[model samples]
Target: MLSDMTATTLDVPAELPFLQSLSWFDAHWRELTPYQMLQRYERGWRHRGVTADLSHEEAAFLRGLIQRFGSAIDVPA
Candidate 1:
């Protein structure tokens, strides 16, 4: 389980497009700073939780997204 360290109840839309929902997650946690929220997204998706239920293609794309850019996220601008 990706440690649900924060006691948050995100209102993510189950039927929303993958990218859109990700953007939403990003926007929602803006206070945490982009880097911080991105880390949370990566962590949240790492274990079997909400993101675990994503479709295979979606999950692959997410993994690809993380691999391509998330691996070395720069400080939030």
Candidate 2:
């Protein structure tokens, strides 16, 4: 009977855009080092005013990076 048949998985494309945006760490974020991530976060905040594109999880991740790396270090002028 069709109802009793086991379900088969569908062949889905891996690079779906909607799925990528929903993930916690997309490919670009995954490739960045902690310091580079922090710099990107700060730049976003500066450019976007109070409406930076970062989610709370991203902010928390940057907080962790700041704690680990120490914010006193200077960026090159």
Candidate 3:
């Protein structure tokens, strides 16, 4: 089973299409910085107590996003 931290971090990509389709990026793009999103993910991971098991595609997507946008979220050491 994946830990809560992992699940929360992985959820970002899954929500990307919906966020974009809703035009959230255009309206609140400034307010929704990558760092802020990472912070939210960290908090969510702490709250959920369970992590996600990412598929290969999901992993690749996240890596690409991180490389493109830059992430402030850090995996637990």
Q: Quick one: ranking by lDDT, best first?
A: 1, 3, 2
lDDT (10s digit) by residue, model 1, range 5-70? 332344333442433344554655435533344465565543433433455554554454454345
The lDDT of each candidate is 0.43, 0.42, 0.43
Q: TM-score for model 3?
A: 0.33
lDDT of 3 by residue, 1-77 (tens): 32432333333444343223333336663345444444444444333323444345534654544554467544322
- Where model 3 places Cα greater than 4 Å from the true spot, the runs are 1-51, 73-77
Instruction: Evaluate model 3: give its lDDT.
Output: 0.43
Q: Which stretches of candidate 1 lie over 4 Å from their true place?
A: 1-40, 50-52, 72-77
Give the 10-residue window scoring lowest on summed lDDT in candidate 3.
Answer: 16-25
* C-alpha lDDT of residue 3 in model 3: 40
Q: List the residue pairs that clash in candidate 1.
A: none
lDDT of 3 at 19: 28
Compute the lDDT of residue 29 as modeled in candidate 2: 53
lDDT of 2 by residue, 1-77 (tens): 33222222222233323222433455565444445555555544444324434444444554555565556423222
